[model samples]
Target: MPDLPSGAVTFLFTDIEGSTRLVKQLRDRYAEVLAEHQRLLRAAFAAHGGHEVDTQGDSFFVAFASARDALLAAVEGQVALLSHPWPEGVQIKVRMGLHTGQAVATGGRYTGLAVHRAARIGAAGHGGQILVSQAAQTLLEDEEEDLHVFLRDLGEQRLKDLDRPVRL
Candidate 1:
């Protein structure tokens, strides 16, 4: 198993939008599409030191040592997915969400509120959209690295099952 990050970690959660519809539409080819999607995402994530925490169906939960790495991985993954040629001119759009906070990693899984927050943030976004929680954004803003990444204030909003509202 890969070494999952412990303590303060940036979590990135992603999933394909309308995957059921895509599966129905693509049938046998859907498996191939999913495989390619995973490949592209894994490559991008690994390139930026992202640890693959978990993946189920068309969703991925990855951890990064830094918020910047997580954001960079998301951007690279999105670009790769968009540019890839699918078998039937099909577009596979993935939604990504990032959050940075304290967490505990044990037995190849993470246990903490931050993990849930990250998953909820990702669930709130549309396919092809990358959402960042305020926690992650704050860390990113403090970094000196010029990622050339810009974020528009999505305004604070309450996410499902989350006690406090998050700024997207």
Candidate 2:
């Protein structure tokens, strides 16, 4: 992986909700559903110009050139999942977090406080919720209303492995 050029970039982290329980309950059936979910998420990310950087189980890490694109992708992903039917007793919801900041990309991987912050924010969000950092929020403030998405400020939250609280 090559190093990412120095500049501001937006990071988006998403994870499926209740995945552990679903997998435990559905067994082989859960695997099939998860595969379909990944396909849908991948398409949504690509459609919004998001770069799929990494995937760990049901969690996806993506990078975008702009905050707007990240937000749109998150919303679109949720909408797409909502429209799909799931196996009985299986509910698929996604939690997403977005942050904008400078990061170092190397070996086709991204690292830095930005990525950590984004992950923290994602953890703070409830299933089916999209949480954006203050920087991301500022970028989307003007357009959020027009986009018909409601963004509730979550103030500051202390995240694991981070020194300071991240605003979402």
TM-score of 2: 0.93
Where does candidate 1 have its weakest 10-residue lDDT segment? 141-150
Clashing pairs in 1: none
Clashing pairs in 2: 1-107, 1-108, 4-105
Candidate number of the best TM-score: 1
For model 2, residues 1-168, the per-residue Cα lDDT tens digits are: 323334688899999888888888888898899898899988898898888888999999999888888899899998888888887667898998999989988778888888888888887778889989999999888998888888888788888888888787
Go through the candidates in order and give each one's C-alpha lDDT. Answer: 0.93, 0.86
Cα deviation in Å at residue 82, candidate 2? Answer: 1.4
| Residues 75-164 of candidate 1: C-alpha lDDT, one tens digit per residue | 999999999988765989999999999999999999989999999999999999999998889988866258887887899989999988
TM-score, prediction 1: 0.96
RMSD of 1: 1.2
The residue ranges of model 1 lying beyond 4 angstroms of the native Cα positions read 143-145
